[model samples]
Target: MLPLSYAIRNLLRSKSRLAQTVGGSALVVLLVMAAVAINQGMSRVLSASGSPNNVILLGTGSEESVQRSEVSENTTGIASASIPGIQEILGVRAVSGEIHFMNYISSDDGSRAQALIRGVSPAILHVHPEVRLTQGRFPAAGEVMVGRLAWRNLGLKQDRLKIGTSITLNDQTLRVVGRFAAPGTVMESEIWAAIGDIRVVAQRETISCVVIRLEDPEDFSEVDLFAKQRLDLELSALRESDYYGRLSEFFSPLRAMIWITVSLIALGAVFGGIHTLYAAFASRVREMGTLQAIGFGRTTLLLSLLQESTLACLTGTLLASTLAMLLLDGLTVPFSIGTFSIEINSTVALIGILSGLLLGIIGVIPPAIRCLKPALPTALRS
Candidate 1:
């Protein structure tokens, strides 16, 4: 068998080719990590946002999107009175009727930006325990509480939405009272205001959805039955978690697009590496012939080729892991309704390393097989 040191020494023979393969491998791994990070980030946010014990009441035929759903002002009272397994907080049923609006908000500097606004009552805090104010007080009528990442969602600077800033909504000036955060959830990118205020400013007479927390998760059947009996309101019951999960599925095409685009670029890089490996192996045919003459098996040469290619790929993996950790780890990106942190954790790193090794094997095997298929005398003479 050829010594592993032979494979290592052969790589140093052409520093330029070594550098090219290493650099190209690193770029391909980096693209893969970026794509994985995006999909993982979106999934994390959606998964963290829901509780199985919670059920949403939306208008029938609008289960796909809450923004398009409309529940009547009397829906909340009817649900609280009719539902049997609703969670109660200090004698108050954990039922919240909210008005969800997406509209252009005029900032302090007179610039308009689109934002997701949720109009809620004081019971919101009781219903959604994940949301907590980090600064100042909760928003009241004529006031709005901006999410911590709302500025990014609005494409504006943080100072523009900070506490004490004034925003205009339909000619009405609303003051920023606080900033809240719901970590690992899309709630961190919304603005909360009083329901009456939203109704007055947005000029909408309808409630978007009713969010209800059940005492027992298994009580979803009761909620479903209630929705079915209420044919008058034309309402449907959906689990809160399932709603966000569906939203995640709706964005799946984006993840697919990312993979397709990055895979093509990585494929090009793999082809480039294959070319480099072919030339490097072709240049060493005389050496291979001499090794064969000295009683080394052809399999030894093939294994040595694998060893050399893997080392180059592993070097690139090291570089890519470092860059991903420094840049993508914990990096926050805004989405349609909220923001999520790109998580480059241990699993993602492991996947990236394995992908790099796979690329190396795929790029090297065909060229190695081709180079070793010649007659011994022909290889020696060439």
Candidate 2:
């Protein structure tokens, strides 16, 4: 059997081939890691955004999107009074009627971008306890509060949305009064304002939905029953967690598209890596024949070849992991609904390492088998 040093020395024999193998593997693994991060980030944010104890009252037939749903402005008052078992803080019910508006807003420099804006009263804080004010205070009339990561969605610099900066919505200028954080939730990318301000700017008489936090998750049955019995309100009740779960399912096609695109690109890279490995191994055919003549079995020779390839691929994996940690991890990505941060957590890192190992093993089989196929005597002559 060949020593481990022999495989290591052979890898360094041709600098260009080594570089090609490592670089190709790195690119492929990096792509896989990125795709995993995106899908996971999107899923994590959506799942974390909703709480099981909360329920959303959406207009009938508009359950898919809150931005499109329209409920009566008085629904908040009616639901708070009618719904039993709702969470109460200091004798105040946890019911928030919010207006979700998506529209173009202009920055101070006249840069325009579409943003997800939510109009809410102070009751929102009770319904969404995950939100915490990191700076200044909650938005007041004629003012707005930006989420800590909202700048990413707005396509502006962080300082541009900082306190004291102003943004224009529907030609109305609103000052940024505060910054808030809702870790791991899509709300982190939204802009919040006073409910009346949004109503005036959006020119909507109806609110988007009514969000209610219940004392117990089991209380959802009562909420559902209420929605069913209240035929005048034209309302449908859905658990907050179920709503976001549906959103995740809605984005399944997008995630599939990402995977499909990565697979096609990786297929090309794999074929190219195969050609490189074949060429690198083919050049050593006579060497392999000489080793076989010296009592080394075909299995040992194949293992040595695999060892060399796997080493190169593992090295590429390390490179990809480093790059992902530095560039992709914790980066916020904005989509139509909201923004989610890419997190290269343990699971994602493990997936990348496994991908590299698979590339190393599967990529070398055909090339190794072909290179070892020649008869001993004829191969020695070459």
Q: Largest lDDT belongs to which candidate?
A: 2
**Cα lDDT of model 1 by residue, 67-145, tens digit:** 8898998899899999999999999999999998898999989888888999999777766888889999988889999
Location of the lowest summed lDDT over 10 successive residues in candidate 1: 122-131
RMSD of each: 1.2, 1.2
Cα lDDT, model 1, residue 188: 91
lDDT per residue (tens digit) for residues 177-256 in model 2 = 99999998989999999999999999999999999999999999999998999999999999999999999999999999
Residue runs of model 1 more than 4 Å from their true location after superposition: none
Q: TM-score of each candidate?
A: 0.97, 0.97
lDDT of each: 0.90, 0.93
lDDT of 2: 0.93
